[model samples]
Target: MRAFHVTFEPFSGGCGCGRRGAAVRGADGRTDALRLRAAATAHVACQVTKPNGSTHTRMGIKKLIIFLLVLSLCLEGGSAKEKGTKKGKKKGKQVYCPSQLSSEDLARVPANSTSNILNRLLISYDPRIRPNFKGIPVEDRVNIFINSFGSIQETTMDYRVNIFLRQRWNDPRLKLPQDFKSDSLTVDPKMFKCLWKPDLFFANEKSANFHDVTQENILLFIFRNGDVLISMRLSITLSCPLDLTLFPMDTQRCKMQLESFGYTTDDLQFMWQTGDPVQMDAIALPQFDIRQEDIDYGNCTKYYEGTGYYTCVEVIFTLRRQVGFYMMGVYAPTLLIVVLSWLSFWINPDASAARVPLV
Candidate 1:
C-alpha cells in the first residue's frame, strides 16, 4: 500500500487506441495509504516503535488493528468504573459496636433500686503471724508481739482474717457498643454513681489493714450483657471473747457479725449469694485448725435505742489451739515436773533444796 503517482500510457503493450491512466489503489481497493495512515494515527495513539525509536504504521492493514484495540480498551474502562462503584457501596454500610440490650433486661437493672443486694462473702485466716507459731494469729500486726507470762499463756485469740466479698449484678447503663469489647470504656465505682451499695460494716472491727480508704473495688466484666462484678478484699481484726476454763485443751466458737451500719431494714437489705447465709472458703488457716461452726442471719432489733432493726449476717468460728506447741511448752514440762516431784518423796521434804522446790 505504498503511495505511488499514477503513470499515463501505462498500457503500451496492450492494444489501446488512446493513452490510458493507471489509478493506484490500496490492497483493499478502498482508501490510499496516506489517508489510511492519517485515520489510524488520529483514532489510535499507539505506535509501533522500532529499535531506532521511530514510529512506523503498516498502511491500511494497521488501521483496523488499532481500531479494534482502542475499542476493547474503552469497553474495559467503563466496566471497571461500574464494578468499583458497586464495591464502594457495599463497603459503606456501618458495623455496630455494642449489641443492644433488651427492654426486659433493662427493667431488671439494680442501680438506685429498693431491691436487696446479694453477695458471696467467704472468710479465711492466715495463721503464720510469727515464727514457729501454732495458734491462730490474733491481729496480723498485734499477735506477733504478744507475750505469755505465767499460766495465762497470754496470747491474743482474735482472728486475723481476709474476707472475700463478691457481688455480680447487671446494670444496663454499663453496656458498651456491640462492636467494641470496650477498649473504649471501663467500669469502676464511679460508673455506678447511681447504684446503691449495701451499707455493710464489721460490727466488731478492732483494727483494719486498709483503714484510710475502702477495701472495696468494682470492675466492669462484659458490655454485651451489662454484667459487672464487684469484689472486695478485707483484712479485719475482731477481739474474740475468751473462756479459758479449758486452758490449752479447749475449742472456742467465736463470732463475727456483719450488719448494715445505719440503714434500717426498710431502706436497705443484704442477702447471701446462695440460699444458705454462710459460705466457707476452701483455704484453711496455716497453723490453727478452724471450721465453720454456725452461720445465722436475722434482724437485730434495737428497740431500746429507737434505731429500729438492722439486717445481720453472723458467723461462728470453731477453732482449737494447734496443741503441739502447748504440749511441748506446757504439758510436757508440767508432766516432767510432776514426775520429778516424786523424787521429793525419796529425799526428805524436810531438806532445804527439796523445800525450795516444794514451795
Candidate 2:
C-alpha cells in the first residue's frame, strides 16, 4: 500500500470555486488535477488518509470551510467594536459654541458670588447720570493728607506738594447681597470706570500728575450703604503769590482749591470731612516751616455771569520763611566788609596795599 500527503496554501482570488490557484501537491508520484471547493480565505494544512486506495477529498474540504468561517466572524466583530469606541469618544468631546447660545442659556451657567453681584449692579447702571439726578444735591466729602512738601520757589511763584486725595459720596444704587458680612468691600482700580465719580478738578493747579508706579496708586472702597470712597496719590504744583518785600522774613500763603468741572451746585456740592479733614506728616522744607495752625479750609463757592455758581472747597497753607540761611550768607558777610573798611582807617596811611584793598 502507498501513502499520500496533502498540503493547503492561501487562496489568491475571491471566495468559492471558479478561482484560479496553485494546484495542491500530493505525495503519490502522480500530477492529477484537483479543483478545491474550499473558501478563498482558509489558510491551514491537513492530512488525508487513503485506505485501500480510497480518497477522502470531501472530508478535507469540509474542515477547511468551517475553519475559515470562524476566522471571518471574529475579524468582523473586532472591527465593529473599534468603530463603537471611536463614536463614544466623539460624543464625549462635544462642546457648544458661545455665539450660538441664547440669553437663557447664559443664565444657566454658574458663577461665583462676587461676579454675580457685580453683573447685577452694573447691568443697567449708567455712569453719565448723577446719583440723585434732578433731586437733592450729591454731597461729596473731601480729605487730603500731605505726604511731602516741596520748596516754595520765589522765582516761579509756585509750590509743589505730594498728597493723597480722598473723596467720598453715596450712590444708593449698588445693592449689596443680604448675606454679605463685611461693612465694606475694596474693589480693583479698574472698576473705577464702571461707576459714576465726582468731576472734581483743581482750581489753582499749575501742573499736576497722578501717580502710577507699581500699578495705578488708586484705591476704591464700596460701603454697604452705597457710600463710595476713592483715594489717589497726586503730585501738584499750585500757584502761590509771594511778598518778597519782606525778604527772608516773608510769610506766603498757598492754596489748593477743589471745584466741580461740569456739575454745578445744583447737582453736586463739595464739603470737608467733619474732623481732621486735612492731615500733615511732619513735612519739612528747606527755607519754610508749615505750621499746623495755619492750615485752613472753607467753602469757596462763587457765582459766574452766564454759568451758575459751582461747588468749591479750598485748603490754605501758610509758609513762614526761615532767616538763618540769609543771616549767615548775606547779612553777616556785609557786616564783615564794613568793619574791615573801618580797619583801613585804623591801620594805615602807610600800608597802601591793605588800605586800598579794604576800601
Candidate 3:
C-alpha cells in the first residue's frame, strides 16, 4: 500500500480563501489528494481560533527551541576543555624548589632574582663523587674553637674535649651570578647532606659524638668567590698519656690529631688557617692549669700499609698540675700528726694507755 504525507498552512481569511496544503498522488490520484488536503485544513482551523495572534505564537515556540539547543552545546564544549587541561598536568613533571629555605622564606624571594643560586649549580650535581674528578688535589683550610676542656684523668690516660671544627674549600663548578652583592650566604644546616664533603676523622680519638640536642649542630656558608664552609660541634675522648714520676708537681702533655680517612694526599690536602687557626674560651680544670697550646700545620704525608700516603694535622696542649691541693690534703696533715707524736713522748711516761693510742 502507498501512503501520502501532507502539510497545511493556516487560513488567511475566515472562509479559508488563500492557503496551500501539500499532497501526494496515488493510482486514484485526484480523489485521494482532495481527501487528504481537506482533512489537514480542517484540523488546522480547529486548533487556532483567532487568526490575528496564531502566526506570532507559532514563531515564538520555534525560537525558544533553538535557544535551548545552543546553550546545551556550549556547556558540553567547556567541560571537555577542562578535562584536557587536567590530563596534561598529570603527564608533566613538577618543578623542584630549594630545600635550604623554608616555604615562608621562599615566598620572600623574587621570581626573577638570583637568590636561589643553588638551583643552577645543582642541576646535574652528584653528592657521592668528589668535586675535582680531573686528578687535581683540593686544598682545604681547617680551623677550630675549643669551647671547653675538662675530664683529664691520669689513671685512664685520656681526656675529653668539646670543640667546633670548621673547614673551607673552593669548587670552581659552583658559579656565582655577576650581580651578586652579598659577601657570603648562609644556608640551612640540612643542606650539608646534599653537598660533597671531605672524609675526615680524628686519629687519636677513642670515641666521639656529634651534638644534636635540640637540632643538628651544623652550619654552612657560601662565599661569593665559590668558597664553601662547613662547621660542626663534637665531643671527643682522646688519648693523653701522663707522667706521674714527679707525683703532685708533675706537668702533663696532650695532643689532638686529625687525618683524612678515604682520600690520600694526591687527591686532598689540609692546611691550617694562616693567621689564627685555633681559638678557645676561658677554660679551667680541677687538677691542672693550662700552660700553653701549639698549632702545627706542617706537611704530614704518611704512608699506610694498604692505602697510599695520607695528610694529617696536630694540636698540642700543655697542662701543669696545681700543687696546693696536695699540700693542704696530704703534706700538712702528715706534719701535724708527726709533731703530736713527739709531744706524747714528753708527757706520757706514766700514761701508757694515752701514749699507745697516740703512737
Candidate 4:
C-alpha cells in the first residue's frame, strides 16, 4: 500500500533587495530551503523583472530550473534520510494492539494457540536472507571472481525476506455485514490486540552491524474464520564461519540457525516454509562450488535452574573452494617468482645473491 504525506511550511518576511516587508521566514523554525528559493524568485520577479520587460522571460526560466532542481534534490535526500532512520530504529520493545473487542469477549478467548488453529509462518515472497556461504560473498556468480587467487573477493548482498504468520480465530464483536462478507480484512497489526508473535532471531550472526529493511508489523490480514495473518520483511547481513586452512582446495560448511528464545518446544514449534523442514537456498558463488545443503533440527535442553528445551533449525551450506582461482593468483605467482629466483643461482658463485636458493 502507498502512503501519502504532505507538510506545509509557512513563509514570513524578504531579501537583500531594498523592498521593505518583502522578505520571507519560517513561522516556527529556521527558514526552509524551498521557501527561501520562493522568496528569492518573488524578489527577482517583483523588483528586477518589473523594470526590464524582456528580462522577465529569462528570469522566469531560471527560476523554474532552480525550483525543479531544489525540489528534486530535497525530495530524494528526504526519502533516503527517512528510510535510513526507519531501518535504524528497529531495535525496541513491541506493543500489541488488537481490533476493538469487548472485555467480556476478550475473556472468552484462549491464552495460546490451540491444536486446531496452529499458526504457520508462511514465506509470502521468496526470502533472501544472508545469501553468501561460509563467510564468502557468493550470492552472485559474477562475484565469484579469481581476483588475487588466495585473497578473499568481496561483494555486497542485501536480502529482503518476507514472512507471514497467520492463524484463524475470529471474534463475534468484529463481524461483518452481508455485503462485506469477505473472508478477510486488513488492518495495522498494532491496532489488533491478542496477536501472538514468535521470538525470532538470526543465531549465527558474527557481525554487530546489520541493515533492518523495515521495522513495522506492516499489515495484519484478519479473516472471517478468525484467521489472523501478519506479514513483515527483515534484512540482515552475516559472515559465516570459514576455516580457509586448506586455502583454495578446502570445503566449507556454514550454518544459519533460528531458534525460539523464551518459548520452549512445548509452547512453540518451527519448521521450513517449504520442502524439508530445514530447507535452504543454493549459494550463488561461481568460483566456490556448493557440495551439498544440509539441515539439522533438535531441541536444546538445559538441566539448569528454570531452563527448558527449545527447538532450533540450523541450515547448513557446504561449499567447495575452487582451486583454479588460487592456483592462478597465489600458487602460479609464487611458482613464477621461484623460477625467476633460479636465475640468480646462474650468477657467479662469488656473488652474494647466489648464496640464497630460490627453489
Q: Which has the greatest lDDT?
A: 2
User: On residues 255-332, what C-alpha lDDT tens digit does candidate 4 reach at each position?
Assistant: 555666765555555554443333234444566775333333343333335776665655555567788878898999
Ranking by lDDT: 2, 3, 1, 4
Could you give candidate 2's per-residue lDDT for residues 1-359 as a string of tens digits?
33333433443333222223234344655532221222223233222322245444786768866765675666667767887999999755544333334668657655656645555666677887889888999999999999988998888999888999999999988756666777888887877877899999999899999998877899999888889999999999999888889887888888889999888899999999989899987877888889888898888997887889999999999888889978988999999988886787688587888777676
Q: Which stretches of candidate 1 lie over 4 Å from their true place?
A: 1-157, 168-186, 189-194, 211-228, 275-287, 292-304, 347-359
- Model 2 CA lDDT for position 31: 33
Give the alpha-carbon lDDT of every model: 0.47, 0.77, 0.73, 0.46
List runs of model 3 lying over 4 Å from the truth. Answer: 1-115, 291-300, 353-359
Worst 10 residues of 2 by lDDT: 33-42
- Could you tell me the C-alpha RMSD of candidate 3 in Å? 26.0
Provide the global lDDT of candidate 4 against the true structure.
Answer: 0.46
The per-residue C-alpha lDDT of model 1 at residue 259 equals 67
RMSD in order of candidates: 28.9, 24.6, 26.0, 15.3
What TM-score quantifies how close candidate 3 is to the native fold?
0.65
lDDT of 1 by residue, 1-359 (tens): 35533322333333211132233345455554444334444333323332345555577447757675675666567668878999998855542111233445545756443220110000111211221134321111000111111111236756666555555544444444454433323444442333334456778777866422542344433335544455555567776777878867766666666667766555444444556444554534434565434334443433226777775555565666677878888889999889887776777646877567654
Which lDDT value does model 1 have at 184?
29
lDDT value, candidate 3, whole model: 0.73
lDDT of candidate 2 at residue 156, scale 0 to 100: 93
